[model samples]
Target: MGLTFSANLGFLWQELPLPDAIRAAHRAGFAAVECHWPYDVPAQQVAAALSGTGLRMLGLNTRRGGPGENGLSALPARGAEARAAVDEAIAYADAIDAGAIHVMAGFATGQEAEAAFIDTLRYACAATTRTILIEPLNSYDAPGYFLTTTAQAEGIIAKVAAPNLRLMFDCYHVQLMEGDVTHKLERLLPIIGHIQFASVPDRGAPDHGELNYPHIFAVAERLGWPLPLGAEYKPGGPTEPTLGWLLR
Candidate 1:
């Protein structure tokens, strides 16, 4: 079977409840789709869009906060707030029938932040059956972001030791932070529950950039990863023109 692909709604935020987008993805032959926080659209609307289009809901990002809000990861010191956020995210995921929730760690610095993140993760894992993914954002893209390295993420996962917690391996961030993609994937594949990608340097369609995606996909196939691969990139224009290569 081909790789299960998920269209990331962040890149197509202008068009939503995204019925047309889902139809387009289905016409192009994708099995699933994902989105960032869809707080603007009612959960029922999102569910309706999926039902009509025959597209499976892969995942969605959980909310952090408004402009001034530091975000859940930054609030690790506030266990009660973190727990509330995790609970809210899990409830949303359960509502949408989404298989995973990508928990974003906002920019928070210091050892205290680390302690809070670990503690919150343990609580989240215990509370939800759906997988929770912690993604490492690129420092350049998100300066002051708390989690930015595979090693750091692995360390947190090790400490949490929950089967429900896993890393959201974004190739774009990893490529920017550390260039050795294949080697790192080999090392972290077992712990990775989900994957996302964008072209390096520009965060566009996969084929437009330096990373060799076919080879990467081949490696993933070899590893027998059963999860969906997230198409979390900006389209050069319409998504189809940029993603034509994947259709072949």
Candidate 2:
């Protein structure tokens, strides 16, 4: 079966406006698009762009708490702020018809932080019907981030116990933090809400990565994973030139 791709506009076409980025993804043969944050752009314009391009907006991240704060949900002292961010993400997602919202867990640790995250997730899940995602960022790239492993994320999901709450499994991070990507994918398939990928180490296009995306994709296909796996990578230059990997 032909695999579908979702261009992550946050990394691709960074030079263009949000609306223009959506159009670019459509023109580039991406089945859909996802983003880091779209709050700066008006929801109406973003909605219109998605409507015009006929591309599904896959998922988006909640607002980072403040400067140096990667996320807010796990901050024990920032309960109000975390919930506010969740509300904002839900509103924006609803307007643009995004499929999921990735709740960022800021720099934190311990039982208190876990409790805070679970509480915040409960609020987020009840507030919207859209799927809620929590990603385990690599400790190397995201040092001190609350979540760092798939097992940790799975445990949190079990604790939160919200059907809408699932994991955002990014291949690059998983490969960096832990190896054996294919086996982990099969094991964690039940709780994975979204899948994203980039080249390992440098976070570049997947074509030249240490990991073989084609084989990984084949394993994913056999697992009956959903369509449009996310292409979230830094292009280094203009995104158009880096898209050769998409056709491979």
Spell out the clash pairs found in candidate 1.
none
Cα lDDT of model 1 by residue, 46-143, tens digit: 77778888788787776776585436755655677777777777887787788888776677878888888888788878888888889998988788
* Clash count of each predicted structure: 0, 1
Top-TM-score structure, candidate number:
2
Candidate 2 overall lDDT versus native: 0.94
TM-score of 2: 0.98
After superposition, candidate 1 runs with Cα above 4 Å error: 68-70
TM-score of each: 0.93, 0.98
Kindly list the per-residue Cα lDDT of model 2 for residues 1-248, writing each as its tens digit.
Answer: 56799999999999999999999999999999999999999999999999999999999999987788899999999999999999999999989999999999999999999999999999999999899999999989889999999999999999888889999999999999998999999999999999999999899999886899999999889999886899999999899999998866
lDDT scores of the candidates, listed in order: 0.80, 0.94
